[model samples]
Target: MNAKNSIAELARWIDALPNTRRLAGHELHNYRKQFVDGWRIDLNLAENVSINLLITAQFPFVSPKIALIDRTKFLSWPHVEKDGCLCVFPPNTNVDPYRPVEVAKSLVAETEALLQCLLDGNLDDDFNREFDSYWLLSSDDLRHQFFSILPDGCDSQKVAVWSSSKFRIIGADEKSVLCWLKNRLQKDYDRTDTGFLVKLSKPLSPEEYPDCTEALLALISEDAPNFLESISDHIAKSFQPLTIILAISATNGTNYGVVELCRLLRANEKVSKCGRSNRVSVNGFRDGKAPLSVQLSQQTKYTKVVRSPLERADAEWALGGRGHDPRFAVLQKQRVAIVGLGSFGSFLTDNLIQAGLGQVAMFDGDLMRWENTGRHLLGGDTVGQNKTDALKRRFETNYPTIVSCESNPVDWQQRIETAESLDGFDLVISTTGSWKAECMLNDLHECSGKRTPIVYAWLEPFAAAGHAVAIMERSGCLQCGFTGAGQFSRRVFDWPAAPTTMVSQAGCGNEFQPYGITDSLHSIAMAVDLSVECLLGQLTASTHRVWINKDRKIDPIQRGWSVAWQTVPNFDTREEVVSEFPWSARPDCQRCS
Candidate 1:
């Protein structure tokens, strides 16, 4: 048949098939194209192929059958049965058959498998084994039977067709024809070459592995060949020795456990990468037979103590006159308030307390829930206890002399009011996103008589991202820092078009969700660094400052830029300070004006 006539005939056959008819015209066209274009199969072979279809419209469906007429070169079931009748079944068949859709799905899947088998080389031993049972039938008998069963006047020798068959004829050779029979009959072996096999040998054992320090040196030597040979003397001179500490758990016995340490050391008055050391230590109680915990302490001249906030304050004060205390210079008189006492808030409060803040206040309205055991700083026994009260109790227990305030009824709104009640603080930190509370605080700082510095830090859902905004009074408030509004002297507070409700129920709330320990640690580090900088008068008094480290490619250090503040007609005011406590112009604000 001509190409056009063959295509028309194939199109008619496909349209008559119930499964093919259900697919959209475009989808069916694409499906046909996958074989004709992708596989590059010869259309002439369709006329000589006798196709049979068996669809199981049940729980587990099967594919249709296909066979080659006049040529029994490569034939296998369900393409050719024991009696030489073609039978096709689906890819995965259970005891029960489902529906026609399921049967069609099986046909498509099996067809894909057949195509892949053809590509990977048809010397499949399993296919040969499965076809052995039907090998007894003579090739002439198979051809005669196929031609007889075909549609009247349909010359089997001239018709080449494609069908959904588990068995597929791939190629014809002088000796034996290549085909994909059934998965169970095909050999499930990987034909990797010798070179690949050698490379796939077992990995070196831990003890047999090269030392990390040596491996690093070797890598540098190979990667920097040109530089290494030329700078051998300079490299030697650059080498420096430094110490590091490797913390190990008790379960890791000595001798069997390894400790790795790498550090930067001073060389020629500059810090450079020094060599690393690895050692295996055995536990003393294990008779040296079992692995022992290994801990390595790098030797250093300076001794640093991680102390609580009050202790750090006292230490700084005692050493301030001597000029030897970095804390004295960093924490002179820093005041910090933490709003929200859930997992994130509690973690931040504890860290700040340890950082030696002069004064710290924690605020939260919700009580601890049973689900907070893993996230909360409080013990599981403290479940159902007020989060603020529990945090305060934990703080007092750890540091009796430290002065910490716990505000139970003070939600974000009351917290802002409470903050206003206290003496003007240097920095106000808030983790809660209570819109009402944030609005109140923004208004108070914007129009209130007091001009206290405010910093807002929050973690996005799943702790995937964190946002921090440092607002210098009259400089750039949170609303002004938003990308929408450029630098403006007049505060532009745009409320969200739709109200965003934060879930409060224990397990269902988003805000109440606890961040991973690593995220919490990172948040604490950022909060502490910013607060310390503000306390030390290191922060720029710019109108806008945003702290973000989303892209790891960027330096992980605390860095930000300043934007010039522009004057807005209704917002900018050069008045030294508001004369009255409550300004009437911002009366439209739902929070305090």
Candidate 2:
């Protein structure tokens, strides 16, 4: 329908509503400049509420914006913006172009429901649930720039703040602050200020929120007089701006608010005499003035504390859990050892790092060549660097949430020769595609008394199929899967028993399997998923997972299919799929016997 019909339909719906009329002339213009039409809803109730529904020029495609026109007394209410706009729907609510009338009707219903909740005192508790929204509403993003690396918790303690003229960063300790600065700014600072962090028993209502340093102290003094005294002492010593992060243990979750107070004066500074030695004097104080601490206590009332936005940049929040996700909490404790950094291993390590693994030990001997850039996680910038070192820099710089990443640029055979080296690891993964290396890792794992599970992953040529086999104590060893040599006992895609599809580049040693980056994602996913399961203690027995790209056309050099392919139902027709099987020992396998 055209814009004309859409506006007319909205008008009809507003006309049908009770106690409503079209807002016209300068009245509508005063509220919204670009609206095609608007309506005023006078909610004839005790509190005398009035709402304005402005239908914008992009109606039908965009929902109408609702404003509470006469809401001066309701500014403190939850979801009520400073501009009197009611957040009836969250941002990015989609509108049906063909059904403009229903859209307006639903918004009207939402606005009514919100007003009812406000009158019933039902939204009073929402102050805690939506505290960040209201707190941020009062913030000036340009002036109050800050980032927080502080771990979210309900404990009140002394935190550290790194402040400069441009911005500030608050963290749990000096080390974390310095580490974050190194990761963000590529530089280190030697100084940090002591900051106060207090956990409130309950979130403050708008009325209880303090606007200045003295009020903040008064608010704290009620329950934590000793903490307030400590904060006063910190202020006396600080020569720069101070930060105090307020955390409320709300019913829903921990809500945060930041208050930054400008420095009143430097505690001590040296003054040069006309022609004599320098003399140190306490700045902003008379020689016989009241003690600096006592004066500071009195000066705080005039010092304004502006509310700043403190974003959580810690690992849990960066991992997308916002600190409450158990899966990430568990993953953050796991230490994984990746034995290779080839194409498959590179992508698998990237996935596991993104999944929030706490620490990783990487072993790869090869340097990244230009040929590996297309599929490797490390880009061309690190072409000459060792894959392990390059990947360590890449992941640590990009994902600072990872606790530690150890890169051993030696051959896996030399680095992990014994099981003792893998003692502290939760899981050991070998994606080397070298059966010899995998055999050694398997033997080492068995020698370690099967304390750490091992997972071996590899991709078939042309990326037509991939496999991830998990080896644990209860299941057969890695040798059980392979009969002899590098060949698996069972194969999904078979070849015509001629020359394989390996291609040679300029040199005799340069041979590579042809595959694109996108084609390897599924295979990477299979290995990372199995590794996560083992880390999370979700897997009970050894598991074998395979992904087949059945859509790939069978080339002339390729045989049709093997018996393993027949196991998947409709294998010939399905485009792409994954299947799982138990990695049980074959009765004739000598390793199991």
Choose the strongest candidate by TM-score: 2
Q: Please give, for residues 1-593, the per-residue lDDT of candidate 2 as tens digits.
A: 99898888778877877889888767666653476678888764567777888877787789988887855744478888775778888888887889988888788788888888888888888887888877777774457477777877848878888887787888888988887777666576788878878777766887677687777887677655678766775555443456778888777778888887665432343323432112233355543255856656654643567787678788888884676668898888889889888888888888888888988999989999999888878889998999999888788788766788889998777777677877888998988877667766777777777778888888766676778888877778887767555556555666656354331110011226566777778878988999999989999899888887654454335644666456644444244677787887666765555
Query: For residues 249-306, could you state the per-residue lDDT of candidate 1 as single tens digits?
Result: 1222101111112233333334324433222222342222332112111121111211
Off by over 4 Å in 2: 15-34, 71-74, 141-144, 164-167, 182-189, 234-237, 264-289, 292-294, 497-511, 554-556, 563-575, 586-593
Tell me, what's the RMSD of every candidate? 28.2, 4.5
Global Cα lDDT for candidate 1 = 0.38
Error of 2 at 63 (Å): 2.1
Question: Lowest summed lDDT over 10 consecutive residues: which window, candidate 1?
Answer: 192-201
* Candidate 1: regions farther than 4 A off: 1-324, 329-332, 403-409, 415-422, 482-515, 542-593
